[model samples]
Target: MFTNNFNNFILNTDSYKTSHWLQYPPNTEYVSSYIEARGGNNSFENVLFFGLQAYIKEYLSKPITQSDIDEAKTIFSAHGVPFNEAGWQRLIDKHQGYLPLRIQAVPEGMVIPTGQVLCQVVNTDPEFFWLTSYIETSLLRAIWYPSTVASLSYYCKQLIKAGLEKSADNLDSLPFKLHDFGARGVSSYESSALGGLAHLVNFLGTDTLSAIVAGNRWYGMSEEMSAFSIPAAEHSTMTAWGREYEADAYANMLSQFGEAGKTFAVVSDSYDLWKAIDNIWGGELKEQVKNTGGTLVIRPDSGDPIKVVREALQRLAAKFGTTLNTKGYKILPSYIRLIQGDGINPTSIQKILDAVTSAGFSTENITFGMGGGLLQQINRDTLGWAMKTSSARVDGYWRDVYKDPITSVSKRSKRGRLALVHHQGSYMTVREDELAEQNNILQDVFLNGELLIDDDLTTIRERTKH
Candidate 1:
């Protein structure tokens, strides 16, 4: 809390972002930047536009304020960089403290093919061209990471649903197949909130409290329905009982939450995982678990996910027995299930499902918890996200602009104004002028100071249903 002039900057941005010259062209009278997910190493065929509206409302609505300009002037002058105080002041005076930028984006939750335009940014006023790309740089993290996480979460849901269809009688449990365990693994509270909320668009199970708060605040979700969590235990809780009292720890969990018909999770790997299942849970506490009228989720926190999950399920079934679902697959008893929380990503999740099903168990017996892989273990290139200026109005004439880096062919940028069109049940990128105005999927989400589109979380979730 102490005063430090050195720490005061105009805005919190990347370190390289301090140099303003790096953000814009020398002649930046009017620049148009188009942002897209170019489709890199992701397994999905399409990118989901999920979080742009929230970003626009929270961060981009008011681009620059008088205080921001004054701080920039002070910081830049002290650092011996040319600060455009006049340009910033002009924006504040003319735009009424809002950024004079038009943001056109595909509606949140709509699935658009890779290389299709997700959002486009253009300076509404000719004088603010240099500001467009700078704002894009500031806002890229808001769009790229959330959309990527949403797409990944959506695809993971599809995989889980498919596995459930083959193994379980129905897909009623798909929404809770993958739980968000990424809150602590993310870089910041804001990251956890954004990434957690993105995952919620496809499923509801989450331990990230900030995500629910974000949904209620930004995505128009009521406090009661935004997201949910269940009572769960960590390594500390189980290990705190000491090795000899481990069985008592398992018994205490069931005694607390089992009789009330409430579901809860307990980590089972603090000691010998197999012993906990065989001796403690399956032996001493078996009747308590069966009589609790609630589900006891056993979590395996460490080891090879596929092998550990399959082994844990086999041992649990041996002790608790199994029930044949309507689909003719073997499901565990209603009171017990397995949760694999370690080394769980999209790939490992599929692997675990396959191994468990191959071992004669239904997918319903298992749920997944992903931490870093769901949130922190990604970057802009994960889905090939890029924002490049596609058109610029120079000398009062609009001209197509693009970049074709010799270093990487895939880095080539598009030219002219862009549009996403529905073509043969798929979205396609095309020139804006080539499409009928009504057919263009890109809608004005933010124009000047106004938010044109604010989608609710429920509506966004409904769009993800296939």
Candidate 2:
């Protein structure tokens, strides 16, 4: 979605701008001044420069001139770090130029099956092969989490599609809103944001501001859709002693919202769930809500999710003076939905779908509040993420190799620069090491620090559109 002019920004890989983010204080001024100064003179260092270079060229496209470069030096000198010609020349010699990057995967939102090669990044330059190493953390985090979540999202989609096809009249009426409830469940802020965004691309909702920030910054999803909110309420413990406390809890939850017709989702499994639903919910409140057209979501925190949803829907229907739409034909209640939580994995989710369907509840009238399983269950190791650098020196050949104490096949790193060859629609990793003495035209993605890869998320999305 980035403009063509914006896509032309490229700073040489050796420029201080390239390593700005890696520095302790973050070299924002150097990067900003360099890009503003030498607009057309940008280039990337060795092969690992593809990602950030691509991002700048295809998105920022700021105009830079020699004056900007000199200004950057002035800024550095003012900061007690003198920047000079020799330093610039050393950077140019050591890191200027581009690293070819290759990433292969199923579509971002598509269900990826097991044993797939999620992605691989190979250095295009023999000299700067080490640069490829730093990219693994971010790239793996980016690709792996989404691929796994996409699989689960598709699974949930299938469950809804199947349930809708079974009983509902129009598929369009039931909008499945899958919310990410795992922000606090994960290990770090970065993982929480990225993982939430990945699932949102396939599913529907999230609560993380960081996720929304990333969606707007990277994928252009609007702030409105990304910034959804939910109310907070305190409840008693899941133990038996909470019976005396349950009434006050429900009253307090409703008190905060105050007689409004907005949706209220209360965790219902504390003390006897059936008593809460049958006595408290079904008696005075159900009648009040029925009069006011307010819907109640009985979030089950314990018991089998399949059993809980089945019974909950049955009770809701019975209260409404409606019958189960058996024989795969039924009318859906517009006001009510069976929202569920707790242990919603693929297996548990499948069970809930089946149980609700067998009990004659429209699966479309349900929202899943997924927690740790969706966010933390998927690890980077599952995606087969690897970064291999095959280099081609000034001499005309390539070699691709790696050393591992765990592997038997050439523990020593492969010698030479490598090129990626797409033969018969499959990737054949080729070497550019000097031993072969064969010349193959490399796809010049980076030269003098300019990035050639498409960095716009949509452009990258399109390239995967096979």
Candidate 3:
């Protein structure tokens, strides 16, 4: 959906950012900035770090060319904005079109608490002092989107793990419990690629295929950490048979993909969900579902999440029968299960689980598919993400800088060159100058347009595992 111009870092910032090169102090030589989640509105204490490497590999790794500079010049002039013509020429002439900057960040997939630094940027060359903040538009966006998605996905895992511990047998199904059904619901292809990979960090089930490509291309992953999805029928596939042949549509799904030990899903909400669950699936397809030697997941697409899920589980339990686990919670027989893909979020998921488990059913008897809630339900303010120049060098003098307005104390930002360290088993953002550099947790991942570190999804997943 994008052209090669998408990789041009010169045109990646806001129009106002193009004028900021002229707004700095006359003697400015270097600048340092940091990014963190202030955690005001959302009240999330921790955020999962991700997607920076993908940005670095896709955009920053490439050199800015003459064509990029020409495009930026034309766009900035048309916007009535100041263009850094000489500065652009100098980058191409002196540094071979590479950015003269250094970026240090916490290792990807590690959960760092809000109000702590996750990334820091500094210019390697003093002449390019303004370059640090120039890329904030793209940089902050790159970090926030996937990090927020990963954090949300991570939070859901904690909730599911708690329910599984009390009512389910083992944690084997935890990864597949929350599947990614979010690709079509997001705003763009990049959103799907980024958000899908974030969800993959916590779960192994997904229908967003773009994430698989992103994993292999950006995160250095092969099929080892690839996501899985069962063949599932949507409303069109089911309703295309018309109400008269509704049973035939489900029967076709079993006939085609229902090999031994396989699982397939059919959305059974057309006409009447109860009739599809009771008269059709429970009666006509009962033997096929029971003796097919595989599992059939029943999907209910409409109605209130808690009530609909509880009623569906009860109906399926009565039809197929259930077995009690060691914890005395009833689990659906191995041949059949239920999935609620409609109106799903963490709040609704917990509510549905609470309702079903309260009715003596195990969370293992059902799975959840979250779409927009897992990807598009957030923004920069969701976790209070921001990037500010914490310190700057004026006339070769370095000084701490911060904003502490008397009106809003929550708008306060951190100051000085920062360093992240794990102290007493908890992460802390400290003064890099005051603390030992050897103890710093932030690694130099990018330098002068070169990617210094490459991480695979395997190590990333291990770091994020509960």
Candidate 4:
């Protein structure tokens, strides 16, 4: 379906991009561009390399067919745009429809600092120098958002880990700390799938089904263990029982899923959060909850998350009693816990944890489910992502090329061929020519329409383990 779409094959780039003359300097035969996260959101150092392998497999695995060229020619001609007919024909005749470009990238899932090159691209054939930038326009667009989402998720993990270190006995549950509930909140299925998989790079809990499919299909992960979610109730199911029978509704959920230590979540804020928790849940259904050998995860969907989560923890602790963990923090009874799914993001998550610990509760007493903030509410600027030409070969000489917009100093681009190097316990961006071959961390991830690096989900997940 993607290959047949004429727009998908072409860059669908800026209107000026249609003219080859506008893309390169006179006599330019080859151009090189590097991609980076240029510092934004005060979390630049938290950005991690992810989603490149999946992007390559999904978008660049197949070569451009003859039909693709024909479609491009038709569209350009219809719009009276300057079409590179000779260049297109040459690619068809010599390269057999495959893109003649070399893409080198840091290994997927590596934690790299900001302003360092994440990936570099250059056309192998001099005639296709314009193709390099043109292709990057799409590739960068496809990658930056998911990469940002992954970085945001990783940053959340670091914050949660810190809180857990102080408030929990063990950090083993860190992987399930943040759950992806952003599937419906995102714009499309593709967005949900990509963003959800990105979140999985750092943590394992997810309610996004498409992400699981994406992991299995694109990253060679098994559906059984790639991502997981527990049986849970939503507003419709709980509200259907009516406000008068709210207690019965809670009883039904526990009765159905409460078997042999099974775990489930019930949305408790559909009618009255406090009344339902006190009268219905802690009052009427207390015996049923205690008898069932299962864990009941109470979800407070609406309100100030920090206040609600801490209050829910306190009430649960008071009703069921609490046990002190080895870390000297109070843990909720084995059969009860809290989930705050409202207003969750990296910053808000940290705030909630701070409140939880300050209120004498362990971080393990609650888990988080993020929606728009996790998947849909970010953009390229979230991490200051950009791809710009750093060099070009003209008249048998490789000359550095960069744009230093005087108005915006931060928009300045790098110069010369680039390589990411690990030095002094951190990754640094340096000119490729200056570095010895061994120090370069960038690997050949793609070449001539073939994916050179295929990373698995487990490998990527392990990279964020620390």
Winning model by TM-score: 3
Question: Which residue pairs in candidate 3 have backbone atoms (N, alpha carbon, C) closer than 3 angstroms, thus clashing?
Answer: none
Give per-candidate clash totals. Answer: 0, 41, 0, 0
The digit string of per-residue lDDT tens for model 4 on 3-97 reads 45744566456656778556566788889999999988575575787888887887777767676767777777777888786787788799887
Tens digits of per-residue lDDT, candidate 2, 1-466, equal 2222322223222344344234422221110000000011112110111123223342323333344445555545555543443433433455442333333322233222232222334444443333344344444444445545544554565666666777665567333356678888988886676666665554445666676766666555433464454553424432333677676576555555534456666777766778777777676466554544555556767877787778877776666545344445433355445567688876777788777767666666677878788778755443333343323222343323344555544223333344334446343334433325443323443333443443433433333223
TM-score order of candidates, best first? Answer: 3, 4, 1, 2
lDDT of 1: 0.84
C-alpha local distance difference test of each model:
0.84, 0.49, 0.90, 0.85
Candidate 1, which ten residues in sequence have the lowest lDDT sum? 1-10
Higher-TM-score candidate of 1 and 3: 3
User: Tens-digit lDDT track for model 1 on 38-135?
Assistant: 98876778888888877877776555666677777666667676766777788778876677888898888987778888899998887877767666
Instruction: List runs of model 1 lying over 4 Å from the truth.
Output: 1-29
Model 3: how far is 371 from its true place, Å?
Answer: 0.7
Assess every candidate by TM-score: 0.94, 0.63, 0.97, 0.96
Candidate closest to the true structure, highest lDDT: 3
lDDT of 3 at 43: 43
- Looking at model 4, report the run of 10 residues with the lowest lDDT sum: 1-10
Candidate number with the higher lDDT (2 or 4):
4
Instruction: Looking at model 3, report the run of 10 residues with the lowest lDDT sum.
Output: 1-10
